[model samples]
Target: MTAAITATKAFGATSTTDEVLEGVNLAGKRVLVTGVSAGLGVETARALAAHGAEVVGAARDLGKAKGATEKAFGKTNGLTLVELDLASFASVRAAADGLVADGRRFDLVICNAGVMATPSGKTADGFETQFGTNHLGHFTFVNRIASLMRPGARLVNLSSAGHQMSDVDLDDPNFERTPYDPWAAYGRSKTANILFAVEFDRRHRERGIRAAAVHPGGIQTELSHHLDDDARRRMTEVVEELARRPGARPFSYKSIPQGAATSVWAAVVGKADEVGGRYCEDCHVAETIDAEGFTFAGVRPYALDPEHAKALWAKSEAMVGERFP
Candidate 1:
């Protein structure tokens, strides 16, 4: 489950969504992708839908989503939209409920909507903004729709390499006792994304369902717009310093197509058992790195630890006031 597959060695960081999914036919599949109003989400939906799958995209702004998807779809069809604001529990519940009531099963669920580093704030439900929108929101929404996933369904959570910066603090996920560092808060939330996948895969894989987290690589999307000039400069300095280390891969911005490629790779191309409960990037299961600092190619060991994932599941359940068996 940890090693990269030779079968997927043909694809890597530079691969586009179409490149990775070339010759792959997804006919009759049903996929749900969130955050479709922009960036990777639109491309992910576009590629899947174009390849003959029905994709229901969720977005906070339905108006914007309609415009974006229409443009992305171009000559392609099979893409639909649902209203969802991960920042609001009401929206999450309503969306989940509507999908459940419809009685249709999904072959894949990609939790891709998230806010990056931003000024400290709280959700409508009073949880930390980054943690709430990025993790708790998807936690509640996905669990509610769990029954709709077909037995062989795969759940792909769009995590980030930033998870290397820190581990989730169960006792203080909202940064109550700890000082709020934007990148650390973002890291905690992203790591939660991975842990959520780990636990979900463990709980559901017996039923022919599995989950994996994905790091989409560094893409120049609006995802990082929250970073001010100084913040961006500081991040650049850190990456530059890291690049100078022995055997480090220098970071470079990826095209949106390349960014969305890994999510597509995990949801459709990866073998269920090989990728289940693992963290993937560049179309392969990433090696678990034991070193300090983030790298372009691997996941941190803590991100995949069973005990860490289990604790996150419990804490997430408590935070959202819901539990899944």
Candidate 2:
């Protein structure tokens, strides 16, 4: 099926939060956004709350999240903060359970929290740090609360163009057998984000729920905190290469507001339903990347394969030791 919204709206690569959300009213709508301590997460929550949506901001530290929200959004009435640390399965379960007990039906859930290229480490459950926190953490959290989502709810997984870096290695997701590369691990986790959304939409759309993965474009966010000097230099070289490609969109950094635009659009845009299971960027369903030129901004074909998505979903369930619809 074609995308419900194939063309970009008034917003573009440079558009800000208020600009993208102009004319939208979300009064009484309940939403959840992860990683609200700073950067895109804070701007996302602030912008949505400004538009009248009741936003629940999840962070690893409740104090930081509350302070950040207040600093960014200024004591908004509809915004609340919750503690969530994606590295620990127990934390993920407890956070979901708390939300469930609150009894608030969420209309949208944005899995925006993730780690970047970090040193090799294992999570509380013994999974690779990047894969565990970025994909598995959100995976278990969403499944635990899937039933609590209101019908027609939107699930937005914050994927990345870095998904082009690698496909998920299901057999060794924790890098037990193969040597670990930080960027490769991060890429696999990002790819898992897309695959998760693809399979999630397949399973849940019939029940009035839909999921989509989003690439928020190049932005300076705390997600890059783990990037050392060498890593940053390599990333710069890649961006420079992309910038030199013929017909490639110019590589540029986005303000936090601009970076948060696509996620907000996916969450509340009217035509978002048409692109369920699709990867989105710049406020629209992104094109598939061509094998010859990786400069174009779009998803890689492997990230959207239904078979791969399904396989990854099963693998994820096994890792988490739980079954989910």
Candidate 3:
């Protein structure tokens, strides 16, 4: 489904979280925001909580998450913390089980936690670090809590424009047979995130659950901590090239509130259901680009394929040793 509300100049590339959520009240709603210890996750949770939603901030360090939530939401009346570590299947399962034990239902699940281009490594379960932590980890977590989603619940997966760098290679997701390129692996994982949302929406929309993928605009966040001096230079050159494109807004960093805008927009915007199974950016469904040079914006066609999404979902279930059903 396409968005009922088309992209408008009013909410442009520089829109902030509070701007996107203006006048939208989320009273009595329950939201789960992963990786809320810092960066976009914290801002996403903060914005939602400020609008009166019960926000659960999931992170690996509960103490740090508490402090972060306190800082973001002040007294933490509308915010809570849960322990989760996407790199570990055990941690993911434990977190989900605990949430289930609480008998709470979530109106939205935002998979906002992820590691970007990092050095080649394996997750605790022997999967590639980027793909494993960013894709499979969220895959298992979502499946485990599938039944707890309230009717009309939305699942928002945080993808990236970096997905244009590569497509998923289902046969060697662990990098066992091919040389590992950190950027390519990150791209594949981001693509997987988009595809996961596509398949998820297809499977669950009938049950009143819809999913969407979001590419939060480029921001200088902790997610870039792995970049070295040379890596940062290369990224800067790419962004500069993107800025030079005709009619393109110059590439610029976003504040935490700005980076979290699309996410909050996807989670609660009234017309979001119309755009289920699509990738979004800048507070609306992103355009599809087919150019050669760095476009820096929009979703790639392959990342939205339903077939690729289904295949990845099956492979993820096998790798994690759990079936969604």
Candidate 4:
């Protein structure tokens, strides 16, 4: 039997991106990050570039991405933008194929682009919005560019604690029959993110390519913009109750740097074998929590179930209408 994965006490939810990446040098490393137009994506790219890595930022709007990076990073030492709309398979294929054609190897790939609590809608390809953009888009793009990942490279999928909300519904991923609930849909997609990493790790470990999923903690970024005032207030109350501490405002969730810490930590700082095929948060490997209701920490067993990961992989290939050998 394999040894268990454990968390590192070196950093927790409060650590910032720079803190986790403090002493690491990435001079010759190249990384691809999605959703760099805003939020953790921009921050993740900035932090990585600040540490000397060549960062290729992907966004639906190149202009917006360039503006955001300029506003955030100020100086672009090793940063460039790629147009990618995760909600559409055509765009996904084009972007991935372009990278493959370029034949540039990447040391890390951070699937950081995603939407949360989005309205009921289908992707350009007719898949559910959250699942299509967050899970399937990354699925197709990553697999297509699999050849460009250097040996010993790693893939980081930005999952969430919201994954505790629901598991993947392979029978009805499109919500054709089930009534569409925003959070549940978000949960399913996030859960899919974890399962994808698990399966990807299994498939590529022999080639030294590892994958892990992480929750970047909560930050009031563009990701939560879909929720209105009432929804936002309710979310705040839930977080307050979870914290069980007085004056636990939602605004106190996490700073952008702190929020992006786990992404960089998992991608380059953490122990590769220990983090391979696992779900992490707060810059450490989270324990597997098997219980009802949201404990607000650790990962659910279903998110790490190997059989479930395999099942999702098969289903994803079918949904995307392509199989990766």
Candidate 5:
């Protein structure tokens, strides 16, 4: 399967992150962005900080994160670095516990750190690498920090259009019974991200907490670290071949800043006040797509199924051995 293509107008397709957020003032607002050491994470943090938000840059490597913060903010006072490695449940617990202990409130929590197709690997907690860090890890983190998010707070899960590749297989999510394919595993994790938002919103919307899953348009980033040079080259060829196919709508690749647009928009947009549990792409709520292949576009029906959302939530709780409010 290909990416989920959406026709919805992007709020800032060609615009840089700073431009889309030009007039928004996040002064005194507190934001924490995972994966902030580089790529879209840095862009997201930079945009928030540029708008005067007190940005907490969370990454696995504190040193790299600090350096990235400096590069983005230039020794500014608005950004701080926090250590977080989502693959380790202990790390997630420690990070959230620290925040909870601080008695601080957060306006936004961007669950942005994620891994792509990689060789079969397990997290410190014995879960699949991508699913562990991308979905279940974020799930545990959000639950721990739920009390810290004030009413009207936003939680953004960085999902991908790659979700179209597959749905959550509750019976064998860790690939114990089924054969493991890197892309399939990634797709399942991405689907978990969407369902997490759906279930979270269903439970928390009345509390004024909303959740959104977003597909940042593809950009050349470090998120593909799991792919070797040969694999990367093959993917590049795939994209090029798909682009050249007759009548094929070329995939619109975004620059790093543009790739971060949808995330920033979902995070800070005033208009998104009532929007929750929806999958968004290109900065707007995506349409539903039924077809497959590289040109595949929009959210599929299964992706938005409330029943599946509940089921996935229950399964996730059992898998992670934690409950979320």
Candidate 6:
């Protein structure tokens, strides 16, 4: 998995979302990007809409999202403001069904919303909050809308480098028997994102649909909202320590636009057509983690296994009591 796939490649980590989209125009294309109130989510939606794509800003609060969209686009034409609380399966179904009822067949679906390091708690569906919201919610949302994905549609799941922390423990996904480590929970969900994309592509590639998982690199964003002040301080300290370590890759913190680059690239860039299932970062297909930056780069073998991906997809379907065509 550490080997890089160079079949098609373009921009790199420093590319901004706008840059990756420089000559492309998504005019008349319809796209849906979740968690669009701020950070990479807002930038992603803005970038797409700026290029004439009719974008949907799916957020937890329609009011905040309206204001955010207005501020980003100056006017929200081609931007449909909608509510989607990923912590609730009911909410995910309602949002998808609402889109379906409205006759929206999305050209692109970006599962960009996620939570990180949440304290012990359960989502409205009584699943672990981080795992449920970040993985199961998107899992249900994507499957429920699979039939609506037109031929050649693209689906991007926002996974993370944090995925390296753990794989999905199907036998104990809720941590009822094992100790619940927030980081581990987050890792499992992120891994699920990758697994989801792998299986989705396997199932639908023949229909011209493409699915990809993206790690947007380290960008300071609202994904950390669940962390308390003390936890935030500790997280910062740990990263700073990693930064100071000899031979470590420089801690390159991307601006929101930069963070949004890869997701948009995966969604609209022509280069991604042949690159499904593999993980990407910094707007390009990542390379192997060399000794110097061995800590970052490329997908772990476990995360990229097609069998593992299919297994997780089947398990997720069973968990949500739904099926993807």
User: Native-vs-model 4 lDDT?
Assistant: 0.90
- lDDT per residue for candidate 5 within 229-273, as digits (tens), equals 766785677678778888877677789888898887777762444
Taking the tens digit of each residue's C-alpha lDDT, what string does model 3 give over 1-325?
Answer: 1222233335767899888877777888899999998889999998988887888889988888788778776888888788999999999999999999998999999999999888888899888999999999999999889888988899999999999988899999988899988888999999999999999999999888899999998998999998777668878888877777789876788888998999988887736565699999988888988766457788888898888888988988888887886
61-122, model 2: which lDDT tens digit per residue? 88888888889968757988888999999999999999888887988999999999998999
Off by over 4 Å in 5: 1-12, 244-246, 294-296
Q: Estimate each model's TM-score.
A: 0.96, 0.95, 0.94, 0.94, 0.92, 0.92
RMSD of each: 2.8, 2.8, 2.8, 3.9, 4.8, 4.1
Task: Extract clashing residue pairs from model 1.
Answer: none
- Please give the lDDT score for candidate 3: 0.87
What is the Cα-based lDDT of residue 215 in candidate 5? 87
Error of 2 at 87 (Å): 0.2
Q: Which residue pairs in candidate 6 have backbone atoms (N, alpha carbon, C) closer than 3 angstroms, thus clashing? A: none
lDDT of 1 by residue, 171-214 (tens): 99999998988889999999999999999999999989999999
Reference-based TM-score, model 5: 0.92
| Superposed model 2: Cα runs more than 4 Å off | 1-8, 292-296
Q: Which of 3 and 5 is ahead in TM-score?
A: 3
True lDDT of residue 14, candidate 1: 92
Candidate 6: which stretches are off by over 4 Å?
1-10, 244-246, 288-294
Model 2 residue 5 lDDT score: 33
